[model samples]
Target chain A: MSTPRTALVRLVAGREISVKLRDKGFLASTAVFIAIIVLAVVVPVMLEGDTPEYTVAATGHAGAVAEVAVELGGAEVPGLPAADITVIGLEDPTAGAGGDPVDEAFLRGADAVLSSDPDGTVVITAQENVPGDLEELIAAASSAVTAQDVAVEAGLSADQLAALTSPPQPRIDLLDPKPSLPVPPELVIVIFGFLFYFTVLTFGASIAQSVVEEKTSRVVEILVAAVPVRWLLAGKVLGNAAMALGQVVLIVGAGLVGAQAIGEGDIVAQVLGVSGWFLAFFVLGFLMLACLWAVAGSLASRIEELQSTTLYMQLAVMTPFFSAILIRDEGPARVALSYFPLTAPLMMPARVATGDAAAWEPWVAMVIVSATAVLLIGVGARLYSGSVLNTSTRTRLGGAWAAGGRA
Target chain B: MTDATLAVQGLTHDFGQRRALDDVSFEVRPGRLTGFVGANGAGKTTTMRAIVGVLRPDAGTVTFGGASMTLEVRRRIGYMPEERGLYPKMKVAEQLVYLARVLGVTKDDAQARAASLLEGLDLAERRDDLLHTLSLGNQQRVQVAAALIHEPDLLILDEPFSGLDPIAMDAMAERLRDRAAAGVPVLFSSHQLDLVERLCDDLVVIHHGRVVAAGDARALREQRAGRRYRVDVGGTDAWMPALAGMTVVGSGPEGTLVDLDESADPQALLAAAQAAGPVEHFARTVPSLAELFAEVVR
Candidate 1:
C-alpha cells in the first residue's frame, strides 16, 4: 500500500480530477467561457473606432513642431490654433538660461511627451504628473515627428509643407485585427473575468459536490470517525486550492505563453505583481465561498438537493461580479470591492490592471482580504465538523453557527 | 503487550442540543472479535468514530495500547467505514497502495502488500480497473483490502457487511476471524446478527448513543434464558401442556413448553412437564442473536 501522505495526495488529486473531468457540463462551460473571453477581446478592438486618440504639445520652432507633435500623437494635426487642445510653442527665449515662466507653465500643463530635438529640434513634453494615455499619446507623437522630418528633408515649399503637413491620418485601418488589449497584462481583464467566474463555479461546486457525495454515499460517518472536522476542511481547502492554483497557473501561464508565442512580448510581467495580489484574493474568495459551500452541502441530504442548497453560494459569488460590473468604472466602489475580501480577488485585480488602483490600495486590500480568509477558514472548519454528520433537514447558516457552540 | 487493543470510556458527542452518543463505553481486546450491534441510528458508528479519535467526544477518552489515541495509534488502526470511499478514478491497486503509504508504509512494501490483498480477495485481475468500474461487491472488497493492506493491530470496521452477498460475507468473516486469531483486535458493527453471533466473541450493543449490553456473547445470550425450556412427550399431540411460569413459544402436537423460572430448579421443571406426558424430547434453548436483537431494540 502507498504511504498515507501519498495516499492522501493521490486520493485528493484523483478525486479532484475525476470530478472535474467527468462533468461534461463543467468542461463545456469552461470551454465556452474561454471562447467568450477570447472573442470578447478579439471582437471589440477589431471593430471598434479609432483606438481613442490623445493630443500632444511640442516647443522650440513651436509652429514648425506642431505638425510633428500631431503626427507623433496619432491624432489630427491641429490647424494653426488647435481646438479642444492647446499645443503651446516655446523657444526658451534664453536657451537653457534657467527660469522661463512661459516654458515652465506649458511644461507643467502638458499631458504627455511626443518627441525631443534642439534648435529646429522638436521637444515634445507633458506637464501632467502621469500620462493620461501613454501608449496612444506616445504613438501619435512618434508618427508626428517622423512626418516633420520627411517634410524638412524634402525641402518642401510652404504650400507643399502645409499639404504634406496633414501627416497621413494613418488611413488608419488595422487589417490583421488583433484585439487592442494585446498584452498578457491586457488579458488580465479576461483572466480575472474567466478565473473569477470559473473558479467560483468550479471550486464552489467541488465543495458542495464533496458534501453531498459524502452524505449520499454515507461516507461522512467513516470520515468523521478518524479525523477532526478541521483537518478535513483543511485538507479539502488545500486540495481544492491546489486545483484552483493549478487553473490559475494554467490560465495565466497559457495566456502568457500564448501572448509571447503570438509575438505579444512580456505581457505577463505587467500583470505578475497584480496576479500575486489576485491569488491573495482567490484565497480569500475561496475561504468565504468554501464556508457557504460546506454549509450548503451539510444541509443537503441528497445530491439532488445539492444544487438547490448551493443557491446561497451562487448568490454570494454573484455579489462580487455584480458589484464589479456595476460600479466598475467608479474608483471608490472599485477600491472598496478590492479590499472587501470576497470581492477583492475579482475587483481589485481589475482595478490594478486598469491602472485605477492607488499605491497603498492593493496592500491594504490584501491585508484585509487575508485576514478575512483566515477567519472564514476557521469558521468554515467549525461549521463543517459540527453539521456534517447531522443528516437532518437543511441546516440554516444559523444552525452551523449553533453547531459551533455545541462543540 | 496490551490486553485490550482499544478502550473507550464515557464517550459522549452532541450535535446542537441533541446528543448522538452519550457516555458510551466499551473495550476491545487483542485476539478477540468484538461485535458492535445496533439498529440504524443506534450510535454504533458515533461510538466507533469517537474511539478512532475522528469525532472528538464531548466527555470521554479512547485509549489504544493503554494510551490515548494519537497519530501513532491511528496509523496502527485499520478502519473500514460503513460509507465505502475509494477514489473513483483511481485503479484499485493504486488506491490501496496510496492508503498504505498514508499509514507510513514504504511504497514498495505497500505495493507488494496491496497485491497480496488483491490476490487474497480474488481481485488481482481487476487491480488495474478504476474503482468506479468495479461492481459494488468488488469495490467493497477493495475497500476492505485497503483497510487491511497495512495489517493494522486494531481494526475497526463499521457495517462491513452492508452490501456483500452471502459468499462475500463469509469471506469477510473468515478474514476477520483470521486476523483476530493472529492477535489483531477486530471491532465491527453490523445489522447482520447471525454473522455477528458466528464471528464475534464479545458483543457491544448500543441504543441511542448508550451501551445497552456489552459482554461475552454467550453470557448475554444466557441472561435471557429464563424464557427457554424443553418439554418431553411420548407422541405428537395437538394440545400443548402448560406448566408453571411457562408460556408456549412454540408447541408440537406431542409436547408443550414450560418456561423455566430463573429461581426455580430446571430439573424440577423438566420433571413436571414429563409427569403430564411420556418423556420423548427435552431441549432448552436460548433465543438466537436475531431474536435477541429484536428483543433489545424493541
Candidate 2:
C-alpha cells in the first residue's frame, strides 16, 4: 500500500513548489524583482547620448557674431559632437520687410534670432530659454568681438589680445581622495554574494516558518505516519531551496538578458563567466543551510518560538555573508576564508571577481562544501527526525538528537 | 477474520524513566467496531501510536493478518492522533486526496473516495473551503473522513469523537460503522462511554497502562451483572438496608435495588422484600456500559 520513499519525497516537494507558486506574496515579489532588473537595465540607455544643435536667424551684423560663437562653443563641449550652428538671413529694416521676416524665421524652428537695432544695440531672442552651452558661447563671442576691436584700436596684436583674453586657470586637487568605486569584477562578485546571502536567509527562514507551521498545525504528524521523517525533511529542504534557487536564477537571468539586449554585452560576459562558480557555491551553501532551517523549525513547537530557535542559523548564515562583503582585499586571509567550507560560498565568488581565486580554487572550495553539506544533511535529518515528532513539547535539538540516538 | 485481525501483543514503552505502556495487548478484529476506553494519560495514545508505528514500543509485536507490520501493512492502517492534525490552509477535499495519494491510492480513486466521504459526512458543500473556515465540529468530521479516505484495512482513531457536536458525532459514527460493516477493523478511543457502549461491538478498557477489561460488549455486561437485584414492593418500604449482608444501593418508583454480599443470597433478599410488603416486581438488572466502565476503572 505504501508508496516508495522517493515518490513521497517528490510528492511533498511538488506540494511545496505548488504551494509557493500559488502564494500571492511569492509571485508578487518575483514580479517586483524582474521589474527592478528591467528598470535598472533599460532606464540608463534611454536617458543619455543626446547632442544639442543650435539654429539661429540673424540679420547682417549679428550674423558675424553667430559664426564666431559656433567656433568657440565647438571647442568647449566635451564628449559630444560640436553643436552645429545654422544661420538664416532675414531682410534688414532698410529693405522695408521689417518684423514679418523675424516672425517667419520663428515659424521655421530657429533656436534663436539675432539682430542689431537702429540705435546699434545688439538683440538676441529665443522663444524659449536657450541652452546653457549656447548662451555661454554667445556671451563669450560678444565680449571677444568687442575686446578684439578695442585691442586693435589701442594697437595690441591679435596674438597678444588672444593670450590676454584666455586667463591661466590654476589646477585644484583634493588632499584626501576617496577610493574609486568597485571595479566591475568586484562589483559583480559583491552582487552575487549579496544575492546568495539574501536568498539563503529569506528561503531558509521561510522553510523554518513553514516547518513550525506544520508542527503547530499537526499536519506533520499525519505526514510522519505515512512517510519516513527524513523524506519529509529532504522534501521540504529541497522544495524551498528550489524556490530560492529558481528565484535567484530568474532575477539574475532577467537582469542579464536585459543587460545583453541593451548592448551591455561586456557586462553579460563579465557576469556569465563567474556565474557558474557562484551558482555551484550557492547550491552547496543553500543545501547546507536549508537542512539546518528544518532543524530550527522542528526545534520550536510554536511559530513564536521559531524566532529564538532560528537565530543560531541566522548567525551561521550571516557571519560568512558579512565577512565576504567586508573583506575585499586580496591576501592570505581572503584566500584562506574562500577555502573554508562555511565561508566559501560567499568568499570564493568575491575572490573570483577580484581575480585572486585561481582556476582550481573554486573547484576545491566546492568540493569541500559539497562534502560538508552532504555530511550536514545527515546530521540535520537526524535532528529534524528527533524533534519533529515530539510536537506537544517544544523539542530542543539536543533533546531530539539524544532521542534520535535511542529511536 | 484471522487475516484481518490487528493483534497488538505485549506493547510496552517507556518515556525516559516513566513506563508509559507496560505489557499492553489487544485486538481489533475484522468486521467489528472495537471501542478503546481509558482515563486521561492512561496510555491509549501510546498504544495507538505503537500500533501505527509512530512510536516504537520497547517490547511488542503488532501484526495484521498474522504478519508483522510492514510498510505495506502500516499503510493500510488509518490512524488519527488525539490532536486534530490537518492543514488549515488546504482545501478539505484536496487534503483528503493528498493523504490518500501518499498511501499509494490512484488519483481517480482518491478523488472519488474524497467526494463520497464528503457527501456521506454532509460536508460536500464545504469540500472546497479551507479547513479552518469550517466550524470545529465540522472539522472533526473531516478528520474522521481523512482516516477513511485511504480505504484502510484497519482504522485506529484516538479521541476521534472528543470535539464532535451531536449531529457530527452521529455522522462519523455511521461512517465508522459502515467501514466496520465492510470488514475493516475499526478501533477508536474515546471518553464518551455511552456512545461507545451504543456503537461498539467489543471493548478494551485500559487503566494505568494495562488492559483492565476487554471482551465482547454484551458478554462483558453479562459477566459483570447478576450480583444485584431489583425488587418492587406494594408500598414504600425499605427492608434491604436492615437485612444483614445486604445494602440498599438505590430506591426508585419501580423498586429498591440491593447489593448482596456472598453470604446474603439474591433469593433471600427478594423474600425479605416480600415480607416487608406485597412484592410487585422482581428481577436482576444489568449495568449500562457507563457503569461498567466506572466499575472496571475502579
Q: Considering every candidate listed, which one attains the maximal lDDT?
A: 2
Tens digits of per-residue lDDT, candidate 1, A7-69, equal 554554555555566667766765665555455544544554234434444444445445543
lDDT of 1 by residue, B1-298 (tens): 6465688889888867888988888889889999999878888877877777656678988887787777667767888876676666667898787667656677899999999999999998999888889999999998899779888888999888889999999899999999999999899999888888888899998888888888889999889665566575675564365555556666666466666565656676667656766677777777788878778877
Report the Cα lDDT for residue A205, model 2: 85
Runs of candidate 1 exceeding 4 Å displacement:
A1-191, A266-288, A328-330, A405-407, B11-23, B38-43, B53-60, B83-91, B130-133, B205-213, B221-298
Error of 2 at A337 (Å): 2.0
Q: What is the interface RMSD of each candidate, in Å?
A: 5.0, 1.7
For candidate 2, the lDDT comes to: 0.84
Cα deviation of A175, candidate 1, in Å: 33
Clashing pairs in 2: none
lDDT of 1: 0.70
**Candidate 2, B1-298: lDDT as tens digits:** 4579989899998988988898988888899999999899999999998888888788999999898887677888888988889988889999998888888888899999999989988899999999999998888888888888888889999988888878778878888898899999999999999999999999999998999888799999999996788888887755444778888888878788888788987777777777888889888888898898889889
Q: What local lDDT does model 2 show for residue A177?
A: 50
